[model samples]
Target: IMAVPGPSLFTLRDTSQKVVRYHHNRLVASPQTANAPPGGLQISVVPNQFMDPSHFPIIMGINGGTRCLSCGTSAQPTLMLEVSTHHWGVRPRAF
Candidate 1:
């Protein structure tokens, strides 16, 4: 898991938000193969005030990217946010 340096109140003399705008969590997409399905990627981002159970905090975004917030709340945990992107298309036959 690749982590990006984010803003953290903890950095500011023992506070919270110990990972703001930092983690751009992403997953390496695999190369396409014959008759193979599409691949996907991952990302992370900061958490906004609004909370959506449909998309849990661990993955609070669309099917492509997520933003991790260094700023944490009593409700949200200060963990690295995550997301994924899926690419769909026809699989080519042998060359």
Candidate 2:
């Protein structure tokens, strides 16, 4: 999984190399991947909310090739976010 952060929210690229997004309380494939398959793949949904703010390292998202929010203990979490790219037709904000 690869995550590219934006202004407020971020876009998730799944193993299928398709962008994934959270909408209406569920995780769905984003139609942003060029020359990709239809509907991408059905990914297991996870709560798209932040953990305890006190967590030593909590990765909310990454911005402009910089670590926006710090996270930790993700050795093998059910869902993972990772990647780098400027999407939505806007340049990423400098950290």
TM-score each candidate: 0.18, 0.30
The per-residue C-alpha lDDT of model 2 at residue 13 equals 70
User: Which TM-score value belongs to model 2?
Assistant: 0.30
lDDT of 1 by residue, 1-95 (tens): 32436422221111332222222554233344554433222233443323443433332332333233222334654544322222234321112
Weakest 10 consecutive residues, lDDT, candidate 1? 8-17
Question: Residues 1-95, candidate 2, lDDT per residue (tens digit)?
Answer: 32435334444576766575545645566666566554433332222233332323234543232333333454464334533233555432313
Model 2 segments more than 4 A misplaced: 1-10, 33-56, 61-71, 78-95
Instruction: Return the lDDT, model 1, position 57.
Output: 32
